[model samples]
Target: MFKKAFMSLALLLISALSWGQGNPVHFTVAQKQVSPSEVDVVFTGTINNGWHVYSTALPDGGPISASLNVEKAVGAKAEGPLRHSGKEINIDDPIFGMRVRYFEHHVQFVQRFKITGKTYSINGYLEYGTCNDEMCMPPQSVDFNYKGNGPKDAPAATDETAAATADDASPADSAAATPAGEAQDSVAAAAQAQPADTATASIGDQLWTPVIDKMKAYQPDTEGKSLWYIFLMGLLGGIIALFTPCVWPIIPMTVSFFLHRSGEKGKGVRDAIIYGISIIIIYMTLALVITALFGPQTLNEMSTNAPFNIFFFLLLVVFALSFFGMFELALPSSWGNKVDSKASATTGLLSIFLMAFTLSLVSFSCTAPVVGLLLVQAATSNNWVAPAIGMFGFALALALPFTLFAMFPSWMKKAPKSGSWMNTVKVVLGFVELAFSLKFFSVADLAYGWGLLDRETFLALWIAIFTLMGLYLLGILHFRSDGDNPKAQPVACIMLGLCSLAFAVYMVPGLWGAPCKAVSAFAPPMYTQDFNLNKTEEVKAKYTSYEEGMAAAKAQHKPVMLDFTGFGCVNCRKMEAAVWTDPEVQKRLNDDYVLISLYVDDKTPLAKPIEVKDSKGNTRKLRTVGDKWSWLEQTKFGYLAQPYYVTLDNNGMPLSGSFVYKEDIPGFLEFLDNGLKEYKKR
Candidate 1:
């Protein structure tokens, strides 16, 4: 029903300096006149040293692929699919657990086109991502507008040119392409960028300190909060499902059957109690079924897996369609009939159990989508016990009414009459389900670097869905189940419909590039939007490395706020949108300190792997970019969690006590003020 933000103790941090390094790859778009009517559009990428740009042909789950998005092509049509040529090599990336192809130094992609007119302008954006040894810059865009003027000058039209073309036809051997010197140069550059006092040797000589804080002791605080949040989501979904026509109407009928069948007062109470218990057992069993087969570890992994995300997207879409009354998605009728037949033939307690099973089977069309949404969200929590807990919470809410109403026969008359409004609930949920499904789709799109569902596009779809749903609520639009020409809209319905309309209006500004902070976690980042009113930050000052940031802070006589964060961290994004964007908070952060953000999931490989032993006596091998930063966080601060924030002075002493997940603007301001006050005393 809702997504939970997850942060792992294993943190790998990123550098803020990478953002301003002038695009790891410089691009040029040129037109090669093949003939009077045919031309080749060649896109050339000159990659900076030590950086690798991914190929467009790479599969999903890898880094962002390089590609051209054609926005406008007047009087010109593309002849064939895009093709690439480069000094390509295959690297087995630990992050994706796959061998993917990438290019180094230089690459070119060509797309032939037929130009029908003399003055054709090809305008569009280029989407690509770049990563070096130290860190990867998130995918960035380049806008290109190319107009053909004259024929490209021939490249000396001779044998040497022919030889050059022949060489580029085949990929260079891997061993010859990457030299030891090239990797060392990048490392030395990082060293040079750091302040003079620090020894780069700590990373090399295994002198880096290891964190001895007990990981288990620290987990309950974060884990408990996360699990409680997920449980509440499940409870909320169950309560909402109760208002639907299919589930609501059957509640009284099922309770009445149990009360009538048992003959004595005590027996009726026992039968109803047993039936309610049976319902919980049935739903809990379903939630555990996946855990039983694959084990909890697999469920944890699937939460972040790319294919699983895409699968959830499609599955939710089907569920949304079913809820919209496109088709029923109940269990097989024969199966329900068999359970009912068994209940009829069986006596006493067994019959009561069978009746509960029958209820579940019959009501599945209405309950399954809601159940599926809750279970899917629980699975995404990546906690072993979350599914059982979520299902238990949902089933408890669902089963309570059945027992309570059976116990008190007179209360049945007080139940609200099932009306046309019940149908209204189902239709509204369909729109919501459809909107939530796009969020999963967006996660997959961003992970695979597919440009299909950008933030604006996501906002546009949501706007349309909410608008139509509002009209349906107002009786201006009708579904098959909604009665034609509804005479009087209830006050509740009118308010809900107006709220939906207001929500649609709220999203209109987002199309012109509003932050839409209320939904930032679900929407893509501001960088993904093509047009925007809010300006990008003018002062680019955050750093990813601890040493470099600290050194710079020391030189400038300021404090350093270490932001423990990640690419996949949901809460980090929330804090960035909700609190960090506040004027006072932003001003304080920008003016008071050198902000350094550490991303725990960055997978860029280290120049060379380091072997070190921590205080816990565990030998940790630091290999990837994430490993180095994660290792640093634990070693320096004796902590391994993020949105963990703390202020540090030049010589690496803590300026104030640590903070975690604090989003209140004034509270954060106080924390900053305290850190500054402590710094002055020092």
Candidate 2:
């Protein structure tokens, strides 16, 4: 049960840490001599499709803004702050809840420096932030270098703005026109074309060794998991829908309609089969139409878009109120009448299809909410076929009973009769929808930077909702729909009430900022909590620096647990709250392994940037503590996403498999155990 709970939470928070899996932006740097003693260092970034980088000129409390930092300069001094090519997008960002400026597709940053010597050189890096519609990447960096001889003749000073604004023109053209720029470009090309060993020698001793080959050998297979999970969730919803008052009564009527259509049992069974097929076709076709209308990318955008989330929140609240018996929600009576008349008039497969359509229309109130919630989830999956796949499962489960009853007519006697108990089911579902509606609203609130729904407030509301649901289930409370007298509470009802009460109790502590790991994915982040007292003793890492951690690991004769994480990573916090806090996991991490957590989103700048090459042989610069660790993770394990965990020996060789953004405690323990076992073997 605990495992299942954890898995569910993991699935809920999957989107938080699943993005930035690979490099979404590529960068190159070059130099152009604009004057005899001055040069323009141009940095160009080519962002991948559907991703963007924030601009350098943005206010605080927003996404990370791009900036240029010069780590080392010899015989030169920076003329001014960095400038960009000016093609930027300015918008009121939903995710950050602020007005932001960013660049998509391609952008360039240029810095001008004045040379004071016959030979001059400069070294620096560009720092930026990136995100797609679904999620954001950690802060990223790219390195730049230039070395050249100053022109012999001293030329008159040029207008700084005129030279800097060369962004309007081509800096490359100027670079090719000048001897110095041409020389520098040739040198850069030569450097890039140099042998790996020579380049390595130039960079000095490597701080961390690459383990890409070993890491690749143990990459996790995550493909198809989302679609399977979506299908199963849809199936669960379908099963729940079957118990609703809207759908349960239709089963027998549908079967009877088929039986009355023909005198022979075989003919009736064949017609019922066709009816079931029609239901599947109708639902799947709906999914296809939705996909065709919006496509996957737009659907993904809608999932996180603020206005759409707000709209969905209101829609769900209305659905929940309807389920609470405030008012009935029905399709137009005329539409159902039209379909019913069509079914009555026709005499073939078309008639059977119309009958299925009529049943769908009649059940709209109950099924629409469930279907809407399912499709919303599928949209967030970022998969084109997810909606269709989800609908297929829902349709299969909804259609299964009619086909089954037709095959075994006697089994119909065993089916439970619908009653006031169905109303109870609907009200309970109302409570659930009401609770979930807050999740959508919270997304919009966070995106718009609205402080209306903080962690404590969200928890308090959930606690109240569930407590009332428990009371309703236990017959201690009644809704307007419950009528005057309470029905006899069945064993399942009692069990569910107790469970609901238990869950409410569990969340009570969350009001004061408890982890309440069960709802970590649903609740607003802990950072949003106004008051928190549930702090645990954090499992401190022995060292934060890779070299120091490795030295300590070697001295202690223990494996190093390299934790590539980020402050902005939601699933990292989930794992820390739900998995690392486990007694067994804590003990294993503290005692059996030396932990080293590298936060890729840390903003503390380094004393000076350092040049390095990733495992993919791309040269870049590390300008901050975050940059250093982030580069190490990419260079060694070839993973940019977090919370990434991999165990390594003292020599920096991978000991076992890698782990990323999962809330499975036992699986994490197994990963630790495997690494430990492998270390012991050595």
Candidate 3:
């Protein structure tokens, strides 16, 4: 009974340590430029994927921002505040209820201090904190040392001796607050007692191997649409617009004018085609001008921007209301009359071109909204030519009908009679506009991390909206324009109603925490699920932290499988949700080894920074939780990418092999079995 209880306790402890996010960060300081007059001190932080550290500014009660505190050196005077590159990310935390600014991936700081020709050594330290989706770590300080006449390729500017420690180290003074000499001594002494294999070791002249270079996986970008996709979307919008009441009637009138303008059939056909071409050129030129003025990135920024999204929400609402017969949005008749007079007064090609321009300006009320919608779509596409491509498609479809009917007037008889169906189409488009407007709200919800539009909430709202839309399609519901006695629904409306109903039914399981892969891209992540039925006896025998995991693995006389992974890593999650969830793989992982999962991108900082010299004698400061783990991986195995899996015996010696992103279950099983066999032999 005692042994069983101990085993259960051990399993629980081991399982808690394997949790991870991918971010790990390291800092290196250097001299950007050296001269007799002065030198530029540069500090660079190389942060791993999925994590971010605070910038040099933050509100009260928020995380600490990066700060550079330099100590006095003869013949040198520090100049200016530390200047960092990159636009600071200002985010409003839903949890903390405050705004914060941070830097991600990589950050650079430049500090220029005036100096004389006389030699001098400068010392300083940088203070910063890191955070990821999970949590935040306390701020840490990493010290640096620089020589006036240092070698061209001086190993590193960082001291590599002022590392974070278990105990507090008193700051030097108000101006230069690097830890005191006594504190550094104590830290070094304590570090000497640890095993050499550990990453946190203090003073050592240890032999080290070169880092093994490995190609990282090509992370797929989930944002933006393809250019061709944008063009097709614009084409779809144009086709829909062609059927609207505002533009359908103009087709016959425009074609009739071209036919009456000239008696020669060839001249009439040529003029009609030229008129259509003129419309295309006009719209395409407008699109180009918009792109040049606003720039492509501005559109991309507006896509997820909160204020812009809100503005869009309101604008779309107004458009939908207009379609619902709230009021007509029209251009002044005087403007149209003047353009018509210009067309009548002009002659030759100019007359035909003026007429085409007149139709565009006349149809602005109905076509403007559609054009604006297409341009907005183009902006979100992240393509330079998307706007132009969109306009080309829109203009092509808009102009084609007039040209075709003018060329062959007989086809005009086949055109569907413009009547009540046009209003139905408008009403249907209004419903679509209302439904999609919610997407901007969803983007705001995710960006601000607000719980207002959680997965279930968003899904529920969509289900209700689509259900109502389906009802309307079935003629069970009526809009403002519907007659007192509704006509039977058309086959087209019936088919759409069935699709909407089916989609709503499919989303029902998502309310109960289903994966909902079909709509996953639009919905919030699954972790937001407050209630889930799938939670049961599962793989819980993993570790969350390295020291605790190591202690347990050694006591249990089992090998350790170091799973280098990240929370923001999709492939890592895929492995967990798919491969690791396999019964055989779970059993093997649970029974065979102590799994110590470390996230290379975790932003949680250590209690203090750990400074160490690598094999090349370059001073590296490991500041965050991920930094410590990454240091171990690089030093021990000589590699720097996740999901790097290594099998280590109880004594922390490599047993069999290291694996990287082999997603197949059988392959992973073979790796585990081989490592276990090697461990048993040892």
Worst 10-residue lDDT window, candidate 2: 173-182
lDDT per residue as tens, model 1, 403-464: 88888878889988898777778888888888888877876675555667877998999899
How many residue pairs clash in each candidate at the backbone level? 6, 0, 19
- State each model's CA lDDT, in order: 0.65, 0.73, 0.64
Query: How many pairs of residues in model 2 come into backbone collision?
Result: 0
Per-candidate TM equals: 0.64, 0.74, 0.61
TM-score of 3: 0.61
**Root-mean-square deviation of every model:** 15.0, 9.9, 14.2
Higher-lDDT candidate among 1 and 2? Answer: 2
Candidate achieving the largest TM-score: 2
Question: Which order, best to worst by TM-score?
Answer: 2, 1, 3
Q: Which candidate is the best by lDDT?
A: 2
Q: CA shift at 54, candidate 1, in angstroms?
A: 8.9
Per-residue alpha-carbon lDDT of candidate 2 for residues 1-682, written as tens digits (9 for 90 to 100): 3223222322332221234367789988889989887899888889865577887656543555676655566666677666888578777643334677788789988878887666676776677778654345677767777787876653433333343334322332222122222223433453354333321211224536677887878766544888898899888888888889889998998888788879778988999999989989998887776566553335545667677778667767877898899987777788889999988999998999999999888888888777777877776676777778888999989999999999888999999998888889889988998998898898788665568998899999999999999988888888788788777889888899999999999999888866677787678766667787756565756455566566667778999999876544444655675568666788999999988777676655667768776546776666566777777776666777667788988777888879876556667888999999999998
